[model samples]
Target: MSLQIEMDDPARPDVLALLEEHLRNMHELSPPESVHALDVSRLKTPDITFWSVREGGLLLGCGALRQLSPEHGEIKSMRTPAALRRRGAGRAVLEHILVEAKRRAYTRLSLETGTPAAFDAARRLYESVGFRECGPFGDYRLDPYSVFMTLDLRPQTE
Candidate 1:
């Protein structure tokens, strides 16, 4: 299936609805757990940028990269819509984000995901993309429910 991913204002109604659905489902997989789901208002902040992945007329997935500094970024709000999972939408969206990060000159990209069984698929995706386990980078503290990861983007050639 053909796919197109583009950076859009996270405030867009379609993107918000997709993110909300995925975030709600992710939280429900456990209990009332805190997993750093950025609200629409927080997502609209300047430091964070968002993208949506769509195939044909269907929204497949969405993700965001928040600028931590000139050389680093943090992956946020990554989710593949339920109807679009297992069809390479997640991988497509993830690779697009990584390419975007490198294009923006980010040397590193970090992420925090859950430790529950519900996250096994997501963890595999990250690992396949060269992300390795790492310590927390931002304001996060040690939490058993969360696992941190990072990937060093290859240097761009002239």
Candidate 2:
């Protein structure tokens, strides 16, 4: 796929639409309290880095990374529209986030996602990229509807 992944502003019309749909889907799959997806304003914060994946001007997916501290980060707002799933857009955006996190020298990356069946693909994608189940990492508390995962970004030394 000829995908273009770029760090972008969340205020773009197309990106805002995609983020809106993502929030709606999250709420539909989980209760309001369990839906932790950030809105546009939150994604625009200086501590967060947002990215968009596009192909030929079509927005395929979007995601963001929130800096927890100098050495840790959190993945947020990862979404690809239902019609655009399986097109590698989500993975592209995720890989881009991983690279950004590493580039910033973050030693750890964590995320909270829903436990619902609707989120199975997302969980699998994270796992495929070396994310493993872990305890809540930020302000998040333990919740039945939420699953937490983390990836150790430190380079392996032989």
Candidate 3:
């Protein structure tokens, strides 16, 4: 399928609507206590950069990056629409975020994904794209229902 990718400010109407839809879906997956969708207000934080993927005029998925430090960044709010889940939208959005992180000179990228059953597909996507399990970073601590992953962007010699 032909996909149009857009890296946009969260203020864009289309992006904001899709983000809301994504969070709604998350809320249904786990209890309110376990749901981890960052609030729309949080995405407005100065540390974050958001992007959405569209197929023709349809928003397929969205993802964001949060600058943690000069050399570190975190991935957040990654979601593929229920209809678009298996069609590569997640991969496209993720690769787009990784490129953006590197463009901003972040040498390490990390993320927190729910450990609930509904999150299995998400975890697989991360692993297939080279993210490896890591301990909690930032202000996160060990949680039974949260899986942490990280990717090192620095070059390494074979």
The candidate scoring highest on lDDT is: 2
lDDT of each: 0.85, 0.93, 0.83
Ranking by lDDT: 2, 1, 3
Q: What C-alpha root-mean-square deviation, in Å, does candidate 1 show against the real structure?
A: 2.4
Q: Is candidate 1 or candidate 3 better by lDDT?
A: 1
Lowest lDDT block of 10, candidate 3: 28-37
Candidate 1 local lDDT, residue 11: 68
TM-score of each: 0.90, 0.97, 0.89
Q: What tens digits encode model 3's per-residue C-alpha lDDT throughout 80-126?
A: 76666777888988998888888988899999998878888889989
Candidate 1 local lDDT, residue 139: 86
Query: Model 3 clash pairs?
Result: none
- lDDT tens digits by residue: candidate 1, 1-158: 68888888776777888878876876786456556888888988989888888888678888889999999999998888776688777888789889889999898999999988989999999999899999988888777888999998866589
Model 1 regions more than 4 Å off: 30-33, 154-158
Query: Which 10-residue window in model 2 sums to the lowest lDDT?
Result: 77-86
Candidate 2's C-alpha lDDT? 0.93
